[model samples]
Target chain A: MSDSDGRRGATRRGFIKGALAAGAGAASAGAAGAEAGDPAITELQPWMRAFGPGVDASPYGLPSEHESHVRRRYVEWLRPDTISAVNFTPIHQLDGIITPNGLCFERHHSGVALIDPGRHRLMINGLVDTPLVFTMEDLKRFPRENRIYFLECAANSGMEWRGPQLNGCQFTHGMIHNLMYTGIPLRHVLDEAGLKPGAKWLLAESADAAAMTRSIPLEKALDDCLLAFAMNGEALRPEQGYPLRLVVPGWEGNMWIKWLRRIEVGDRPWHQREETSKYTDLLGDGRTRRFTFEMDAKSVITSPSPQAPITHGPGPTIITGIAWSGRGTIARVDVTLDGGVNWHTARLSGPSFDKSLHRFYFEFDWDGRPMLLQSRAIDSTGYVQPTKDALRAVRGVSSGYHNNGIQTWAIDSEGRAENVEIS
Target chain B: MSRFRDLAALSLGVILAASAAFAQQGGKLGLGRPASPDELAAWDIDVRPDGLGLPEGRGDVLTGEELYTGLCAACHGDFGEGTGRLPALAGGEGTLTDEFPVKTVGSFWPYLSTVWDYVHRTMPYGNSQSLSDDEVYALTAYILYLNDLVDEDFVLTRENLPAIRLPNEGGFIPDDRAGTELPAFSAEPCMENCKDRVEITARAGALDVTPEAEER
Candidate 1:
């Protein structure tokens, strides 16, 4: 709808009531409910259907043919070619905390290299007392652990700092995905090298065509970091570090080098180009900040924000979205109904894990008036998601990375939500 | 003087008693048992900052260049400039200012240890660790040579590899935010009347709706 239409003689309240009365239960959910009532007609298919012949159809396994709209979206301007610097995930269309594997966004410095798992080898060298190379089978012999964490690119939701450039959440917040990872603890492998007294850091390297590498602190390595092999209970997809990747807990996703091949122990930290020139934040001054690794706590109201709009009337409205923290588990999330005025605590739902997305819901009885919506997250460490103005006040828009601005959704009297900038 | 000595001895006894109680609690949880030698041997594969885990191997730049040309040149480029869709593995020194800053091995990596560890562990496009130990050393030597970090005749053996020093060796320090910054801001935050009022400034397109207008 045009901006000028709501300003006409008939207010948005009258217009919404008329539309709802004319099209009772014709929305997306209502249509789905109307189509599938009978649940028990498929038992005869296995014996009757001819598999070798032309008579067969898929039953339990499928990506809905109609879900073509849910495919990955690429930012054409980001990279010169499609293989590298691809766009991130579309969190707007996704409904729960977990991002389905098919729709998980991808970014590859070099095009995805298909690796034969049987032939893959991970080598540990450098300052280690005894360098060792472990085959995939050897890696599996070690004890395994599982943990769910969110991997967010430093550039997630970066474009919004200048303006509300993207209309969908997939484009804005899609550069992040959460999954349960299965792998061996980094400490187990580090222990094998017999770290010397002065050793303080290690470098993880990828065997991709780009040969990506990053320096990790010794403390973090000995902590919860993992030498991940599987994601979300299955072998990682080709786009996501297929054979092996470094699972650096609570850190940036790019640092989790996919197709990992080597680790070198060292007496000091490595200031590789990835850390100093690219990942480092260049502030307002000429001086550049380095090794700024931790991704801060952030949240956004997915529904009632952009991609999903409110078409119902002023009665019981279900407002929902996602919240997460890199430092630790989320403690609380607040939903602002009237802009930033009196705030109401939203109910946080789903399994809460450290560095994992927390789903939240806020139900309100609307009275057919224009409303502004926003969400704020508080992590276990007591760090609050900063307001857009607050972030701009300190860092300014020039720094495009690590933007956790408080997103605002303005709902008109007509029940439509628009991306809005709160001064 | 006797009374003072008695009080001091009594205080010391109380402190020791408290410590014993703490130790007993820790013992119940089985927290401080040193891992068995076998247990340590089973899982300890980590390489430290020093040259600890390096295996016996050696290679020269001449052999490394051949390996690179065969396995990596397709994607990384003959000169390590990186291809159209792949990341450039060379150049990018002091160019963090350019609109499209290219960070490569020569320009940005802070630790020589990382370069060695990364290359040895994972490298080449399709085949991972398919190369022998000598091949990894050769590849490392060739890459260092390409970046002008080392001479063309440089040989990367278990002996000389640790001697190479990276440019940004002192670039990183322990995170100072918790100790140096957070404490200063930990005082009671102003909760009420700190900000008089907030005003609305912008909105997203999909969020705003108008029923009077025909659907697009």
Candidate 2:
């Protein structure tokens, strides 16, 4: 329905009555016989009459018990073992663009490495004027920068490459997190050591047992890379590389090595296992695409999704979600209520950081009809998010990464939603 | 207080202060000490596509098969078929275009350095960085044999590794989405009446692939 539909003739009392009449079993429990305001306001409540615990109850505060459900969840089949496993951040349960450090999605190759800051070291060797090793204290002595960027694993939405399969937005797109990284510009450190004349490539290596590695072009390393030591105003979590991590802005997450220990300057790219056998994108004609970095602009409706179904019987509702791009900031987002039949411009809000998540919302009064909802994002580079069919047309369904297609969620008459693809 | 003891202490303090000043004057910001040659060797295991870092090593196919049976057969399979959800090292030669593309090392990897480096750096599952250089060369040769790329009696060495090439050496190209996909996808999208009608094509609930929510 249009924005003016409900404001024309409906009164506040009338709207509430209409919603309750259509709400069915969704009404509050014992609503059939409860006296108005008796148990809550008219009577004394337990919390008002009791004393609560003081500040020292917790040395470090945690989320309230009621919010225990809001957490990182993993698909059992996706991670055969805890090692070489991943878990999705509960994006649907959050608001705003900054994902809390504790709730960020984690991808580990060899499980979490617990390192003592005093014992940890970062080494830079190969083709340099001087090879150097910095203790964690020495690293902190350098100038630092704070910038927010989204690190998305290439395999995000990989399960949906063939079709809509995952039930919620979290499972399909949870292999991503946006946060502020505090670190020294890799160029500063590289300049201090001094690159040799023939240096053209960099090999980022991790300290985990997997010893994960990826090759990066020297131009990219100097342009916007970071030897990040902190994230979101605190020391990096052990699960998130602890003392140090590499921040490759707008690149695939695998290249942003965690538990980062060494960087080798060279004249050529090192064909590591992560790059050649895994992250490469396979096409329909037996050919592959390597280094398919830079996540395209994409958006998804977090609310009114399968997990967070609308519950107010559709008088006035808020539809909100997230949009981001690796190439640039999100320029605009257009949401559709009737699938692809029409679109409405969504309002972008909160701080808009480049290469970071942007929150958006579309408020409308629902007329209580079944709907097919979808959102499309256009980035600063003028690249419009394509349909799943559009992406499949050129790349074919063989690819398991870079599936940044528009997503559709079908909402039924009873105010329930399901993951679906529209024809 | 002894005058001789005080004089000795003052002279020691002066020397300590001088060395502290000298250590802080290296490189920019005077941070991080020079890495020793031995220190670089401890962590420098990267191998380039052109065989830049291939260490001296030699191993025959028979030796590789025996080592493979002892160390890698549990997860990677005896013939590199891959047991459970672990990755396969061979076969799936022409299925890259099929609906279910079976990406194996032989059929998919573009460089021999990747196979050799992976075995050397992070193989043996839980016990990574434990294999010797010769053992890594043997395991790589065994994988080549599994992929039918090397003869059963072939011996792989550091010198010969550069000449060896995988089947899909030329199968990969750099990302071209900017050139191939950006233009078509950048047009001003339709705002109204774009579709006459919409119908549900597939549903996630119908497939039941979603893991049970309550399961930890």
Candidate 3:
């Protein structure tokens, strides 16, 4: 055998040897059936001894039972009813760039609408050469594009504006999900209808009970907007607007209307309730800032967080998290172990797609010391994620939306982590 | 007579050829059909701040109060103070600058049309779009009354609804993040000793909002 092959074989044998030694130790400590040094090589595990379930067992597969703990969770007190509620993704348990389809966070104004794809129709009218209606099949006929983007609710960390109100990263930072979306560019559909000369804004209307609507600028609609029909390479989940949804890239999640039905081109912004009353950012001076579309660059350490506290005593540890920006791609992520005293640039890994979640890591050997962990991200636009105090200095604590402040996790000597604000 | 007949036949042939070309081009993609006017109208329920799509309707405060109590009181509370986690629609008039601002329709909303449009589109929570135009108008008036914006005897019509200025009409300014924030935040962030001393100001765990960690 080649020298490389021999090295590989030795590594595999070493792993097996270590596992067997651990198994033998457990067996000897248990019932008096096995010898300590003499390992049972002839014995087989339960799966190896018996026939496994057939492929037909699960027509639709689910994650292993062991992974049941990883799920979208919501604080019951946040809303009156689940219908008009928000559920957070378990960011602490999740790894990598893409959030699993099942665990993508959900924020619905009206409960999920499970409309039949056959009955769904998308209408493009108002200030167009021809008002057109497209069925689900008709929408499929158009040329499509795939993009990976992060959808963050403007209020993702709103509760943290006043102070660090949620301990776990799952609750504080889980209101966002990164997904690979497959859909047609919204520009093509608008072009098909032939926008009139005076058209400046497009009103995207949803088919849900609330009929959620938002007036998007015509420039944005023609730029990077998408009419998504599938997510993560599968038909969208019913709760995620199965028939169709709008993907307003780099914008607030609320503007990405689900169960989208109509697009009405107009000459000016509609100044609807969402843009004016709800999503507007209220300043310290009591004046509200309207149409704050782009989500600022933000980063949060997912591991070593409240949910995924350090269990393996000390020594070599990988401090990893996700960093993203709505304005553009993440330029760099700097992690601070001693709060703002010192900072180290984290290594960016995986596909660094624009306006998408970029996984970052910092390998450190913990010397069994308490740590004040924090992450700060700078986007391609050179907009750095500000400190909590810096953000409060400008927008103040009264504001609920667009609280993209640097999050800090205080790791105690025992390795338990908690959310905290530093001054 | 023969020449005239020949000319007529030639014109008919040209018309037929042009129509055939049109048909070929029209059916090339074979995608969606042109939506009928009626079909488009059914789904177009958007109401702009300019009262562009507000249906012809009228409702007074008395009618609004009765409808609000029956349809919206359970969640919004009779006084629009909001029940439980539901949104408070009234009160909080001068609390915008307060530490805990109570942003209700009366105090925070910039446009009266938004109040009318949202209630018409999504109010009564579960049973949306069940309210008639008149009922929505009444609800809007009642909510305005609750906020103490308008007198009880005032009637809300499409013509005057847009004219009624909200209390915080001038409170909104277009986004200035690009100018005010981006420039200042764009500075090369510091690497070493950003601050002399760091102090723990607050702790979220102390509030007990997060659930207890599950046993491994």
Candidate 4:
């Protein structure tokens, strides 16, 4: 092996030997009982001794090699082709509210469309006094607004609707991301094309190969929608509609039409393919709930989840997660340690923007006993997140979309956690 | 002629009216260019449920069968039962209320416009929007025939397509979550001793369906 590789291997072996010396227990596991003079802290580390790469080596940066495992992942069984499928965000690995543009989840009807901004045009037609077409340059001329919002797929926790199915929080609750979108208000743009008297609905269409379409109410179109051109303070990523995308704040991600090409104002709702064939919540009674645009309050414990188990066992255990509400901001989050036996209010950390993700943390001493971990969010609208059975009692398990029920994870005394449905 | 004079006057008035309407609505930006008729026609792809935007086309079930088998049968079965993980386009007509609802195009879709618009806009999987207007009609007709909505010899036209009501047309209700769900979901939740007992009824690690995940 190479000299550096040999040294690194030796270092790893030394770490293992030190861990064995510390006995069959966690490695520097807790504050109360940590092994003294750990080699990692006491010994001269290679990173400290060596010179890293020059700044010019990487014009654009990526996560450290050690963090390569934190990435967007997908279930092969979900769809046959990658072109028309979904991938999940690595929510467990994230800390703050803003999801890095690279780690954001992606759902493609056809596939990501890479378009030249110079060639892209957004058209406004139908039931307007004057149909108007705006070039990308022209769209930039209009006044812009920035707002932080969470875009969640209606089927975020779809696999777990029947019961606890997907093991990780990343799989079960990762079809969502919060971002600060910079763009012109959709109302301002629609006003530029002067809406006719009876224009009640607006159709947002994409320029992707699929040309996705969804009919939104005119009231919602004017309320808080935006034709966003950038996200997280940079040019939009191609997967997030790069040149342009429509932002229907607080609605299902599908309604936020990416790669936006057209907006047609009409008198009534057009029963488009997305509205009818998909996105609708089909209940046990066979009656589906159409135009169910807004997502309700939901939360998931990112750490201590199946994917993010407690590596450092016991004492000073920090249970953290993310919570959000499409209707408003998350007011409080209640975390239960012994299932529903006792509860504690988690500290809502970070900026809690309207309709944006709110991070929460509940710190407690881990008694090193088997426990059931759960988190529930309460929104500004006073909407309390319900239990799985309470949700199923009303909506039934047949519906895949809008599964915003509480999630429960069972952690063993060893600190390993798994997905489980409790009664 | 007087007729030509009247037409010219009417066109001038329409332009004036448009400018006046914009001014009244406080559309002071005037940033975008006026979309010409040709430009509007090119991008106006959506077809409403009332058959508003359907292009004139005609196709029979026989031609649709050929297209379906050639282009779609790989993902969706020959009889529209679905293949592997792809969604089924037909059947499952009465299973929506069942324990496991088999929601297919023929069973749950409320409007035929969705079938035509979806196929023309994005369909045939990888080769989306590749079908001619007539081909989309044929495919839609074939799907209907598969679900017993139409006869084998039936030719679907833009005019007749909307009239062919899907069996689940009346099966949909607008979102009533404000009245039904919000009231139930938005309540003072029990903080402690909420349940009589807690038991692990189901476990995901046991199911082992999580893709590429291990016990952490």
User: What is the lDDT, from 0 to 100, of the residue B72 in candidate 1?
Assistant: 87
- B41-139 per-residue lDDT for model 3 (tens digits): 688777777888888999999999999889889888879999888889999989999999998888988888888888878878878778899998888
Native contacts matched by each model: 0.22, 0.77, 0.75, 0.80
lDDT of 4 by residue, B1-216 (tens): 999888777776786686566546665676889999899888998898888999999999999999999999988888899988788988887788788878887888898888888888888766777899999999999999999988999999999987888889998999999999899887788777777879999998667666654211
**Per-model RMSD to reference:** 12.7, 8.3, 10.0, 8.2
Give the per-residue lDDT of model 2 (tens digit) for B122-177.
Answer: 88988998999999999899899999999999999999998998988999999988
The DockQ leader among the candidates is 2
CA lDDT, candidate 1, residue A395? 53
Over A1-423, each residue of candidate 2 has an lDDT whose tens digit, in order, gives 233434335532343344445455435533742656435556788889999888889987898765765789888887669888999988888899999999999899889989888988889999999999999888887767899999999998988999999888888888889999999889878877889999998999989998999889999999999999999989999999999999999899999999999999999878788888888888877788888877888889898787667767758989999998888899999999999899999999998888999999999999889999999999999989999999999889989888999999999876677889988
Off by over 4 Å in 3: A1-44, B1-30, B214-216
lDDT of 3 at B78: 78
In candidate 1, what are the lDDT values of residues B150-214, reduced to their tens digit? 88888888777777765544433444445633344234333333345666665445443322221
lDDT of each candidate versus the true structure: 0.71, 0.86, 0.86, 0.87
Ranking by DockQ: 2, 4, 3, 1
Residue B105 lDDT (model 2): 76
Residues A305-393 of candidate 3: C-alpha lDDT, one tens digit per residue? 87777756578888999999999999999999998899999999999999999999999999979999999999998899998889889
Model 2 residue runs over 4 Å out of place are A1-35, B1-27, B214-216
